[model samples]
Target: MAIWVCRAGKKAVYVEEFLKQEKIFCTWDGFDYDLNLYDDKEKLKEKIRKEKKDAEPTAINTWAAQLMCLKEKMQNGDIVLTPNENSKSYNIGIIIGVYEYKSEVPEHFRHGRQVRWLPDIIFRDKMPQYMIYSLGAYRTIFNLKYENEFVELLAKLGIPI
Candidate 1:
């Protein structure tokens, strides 16, 4: 299965919300439509441009790709790692459900996926340098480059991989 790095928010502002809600989410407030409806990134980019008129073309492209990745590319059973700045650790979890637009929730967290979080948290200091570097990616959502190493680490930690 694929492994993903899904940041809770800038500096992990929504980490607690994610833990409490038992899910991971993306925050593109004005784009309320379901991502599954868009078959291509270009179409999504067009919609993003209309919603975020102030955003640069590059930013629009990036958002479109990231949103698509979260919605379409990521599959159920894929492993997800979300940072918890307060604890200075990462929470490991399994993606357990399909994407959903929860309109009743806060605007920044409308797009979401169900997750079954593992009980253990991987501390930053204890992680290998390679894993640390991989998690340093700037994007909000991305595939973890060191997938095999990550699984081995989890095995060492006695957590089911």
Candidate 2:
């Protein structure tokens, strides 16, 4: 996905339309964020200027993202899930499954990772099938490029694995 930075004031809305993009995140400070909604440049720019605009990462989110990334890389069968040192404490047991989120999870338990303390994650496609830890939460799957980043993130989080 591509990200863009635009100046505020007069041309913001027009620019948004011209760019064929619709979803806008109002980063304006002191304002409640409306995700998946549209906002003009002034609002977003004010957010940029205030420095209180965005949220800091929480441990849960960071951990969730890392797990999801690893799940995507998994192939079916038993595998060693290497965590970044910050989060290596997340040792898990044998994963007895591998499938996409949509097909695998039961309908009653679909709150993403939020609902489950330690849901199994799996990547549907790969050399081996995944154990499937973060089934509902992965926005995108991991490829080779993210391996180092995952390790770094977990290491920073304090996991030795």
lDDT on C-alpha atoms for all candidate structures: 0.87, 0.28
Return the TM-score for candidate 1, rounded to 2 decimals. 0.93
lDDT of 2: 0.28
Evaluated at residue 34, the lDDT of candidate 1 is 79
For candidate 1, the 10 contiguous residues with the lowest summed lDDT are 27-36
- Candidate 2 lDDT at 17 equals 26
Rate residue 150 of model 1 by lDDT.
87
At residue 118, candidate 2 shows an lDDT of 21
Runs of candidate 2 with Cα error greater than 4 angstroms are 1-55, 58-61, 79-93, 102-108, 111-161
lDDT of each residue in 43-122, candidate 1, tens digit only: 99998999998999999998988898888988999999999885368999999988888778788789989999999988
